[model samples]
Target: MKLAVIGAGAVGSSVVELASDHGHSVTAFADSSSAVIDSAGVDTAAVLDRKRTDGVVGGGAPEDALSAEYDVLVEATPTTLGDAEPGFGHIQAALERDRHAVLANKGPVAERYADVRALERESEGSVLFEATVGGAMPILSTIDDFDPSHITAVRGVLNGTANFILSRMATEGLDYEHVLAEAQDLGVAEADPTFDVDGTDAALKGVIIANVLSDDETEYTLDDAEVTGIQEISGSALELARADGRTVRLIAEVVEGSVRVGPRLVPDNAPLAVSGTRNIAQLETEHAGQLNISGRGAGGPETASAVLADIGRL
Candidate 1:
């Protein structure tokens, strides 16, 4: 497949590199500042080098990559709230041109799902967002392929940073502040940890999953979800849970027309209690019983793997 990747960040650049190695052509790709366009396929190595050393991915503005030759446009930019611009716009451009759009950004699906669906209805192209919910867990794909339907609920440990922090705090009896700082130092959490700690990230993913599992008549958005982050969780709280053979994890759930992201108490042996940046997604389906999928939920290569898989499916 010919590819145009927006965002030269971790997931975007990983798409470029993996696409090249896997025999797909990356025709155009952009960073926050610029883009590199080529009809015959961009030089993935040179573009990655430029992005790493100089902080610019290409010569033109981010929008220029839209016009470059491509079949699948991978939108891997950071998700922004409210409008979800640039990423949303890039997906529109791709679909308007009858190109397939595979998104790793959750904002477009979680925030403006109806508009995105409307665009898909009008355009020749379609959108797939498996990476939006689970970094590489095949969540959407499994849901799509299920024949005997009726998914009562979907729940999981969706955010790796929050999970990592909570897991460390529980196991080591370390305070929240110490574990969060350690997570930052380990590159598990960003310098500004608000999004991960405040539950925005998990909430966004839960909303996207709910959107995916919802019917056309039932519209769901981020506004419909209730969110609670792991910011207030303390070492003492973990100790209490531990004494009872329970662990606290930031669980995201979509059930009974309600979407919620919050810290939940679960048995230590439960699938959702998988520790340290790993993710687990459980589907309560009638026929398949409880389907659980687990994998590394974050990182450049992991998400890029999901993005590339979506492109291949396209």
Candidate 2:
């Protein structure tokens, strides 16, 4: 299959490498950073190392560099709904040309899932976004197999950075700032960790998951959901968790016609207690009860795995 990878950042680079490794033809890498399209192919490791060393992050507009038609197009950009317009444009273009789309970016699906769904329907092309919500956790496929009517609620630690910070605060009694610094140093948190720390990232994921699980005819928006960030909590909250024999987690939930995102104190026996870094999402459903899906949450390799999975489906 000929593949076009949009957004050559962390996740995009990984998808390109994985597809190339599987012997798929990676035609072009569209990013705002650099426009290096080697028709003969480029060394994945060398390109990634150069990107890291030179800080060549954030690709250029997708419209400028992405002109080739491929069997599949992978969108793997940062979690910026505003900047995702170009990626969406690329998806639309690919679909117009009757190409399949596999999205690792959350913004497009979160902000315009219904529209995109319609476009895919009109184009009669497939669109998959397994990496958006749980990363390698496979939440979409799990829900896809089950009956949506039986789903009563969905909740878990959806943001890995917030969970890592909370875990550090709870386990080591570290302050929020200290834990955040650690997360940044370890690359678990972005330099601008506002979205992850502020709960918007997880809220976006929740919106996408809700849309995927909802009846296709039902219209739902995240405007009504209450969102709260982990930045509001302090070491005092960690103390409360210790006193109550629980840990604080940034939990996003959709239950009983209401959606909420905030930090909550969960018991030590809770499935979220085992989450670390980018580890797990414990989804609660009516029929399945509680399902624990764990794996690498954020990284090129994991995201690449998801893109390849979508390709396989195609």
Cα lDDT computed for each candidate against the true fold = 0.88, 0.76
Q: Where in model 1 is the C-alpha error above 4 Å?
A: 147-149
Instruction: Give the per-residue lDDT digits (tens) of candidate 1, residues 39-156.
Output: 9988889989988889998788777888888899899999988788878998899889988999999888988888889899888998999888779889888888883147878999
Report the lDDT of model 2 for residue 297: 71
The top-ranked prediction according to TM-score is 1
Residue pairs with colliding backbones in model 1 are none
The candidate 1 region of ten consecutive residues with least summed lDDT is 143-152
RMSD, one per candidate, in order:
1.2, 2.7
Look at candidate 2 and give me any clashing residue pairs.
31-59, 31-60, 32-59, 32-60, 33-59, 33-60
Report lDDT (Cα) of residue 219, candidate 1. 67
lDDT measured at residue 97 in model 1 versus the true structure, 0 to 100: 93
Candidate 2 local lDDT, 135-202, one digit each (tens) = 77777778777776666778877788888898888888889999999999998888999989988888
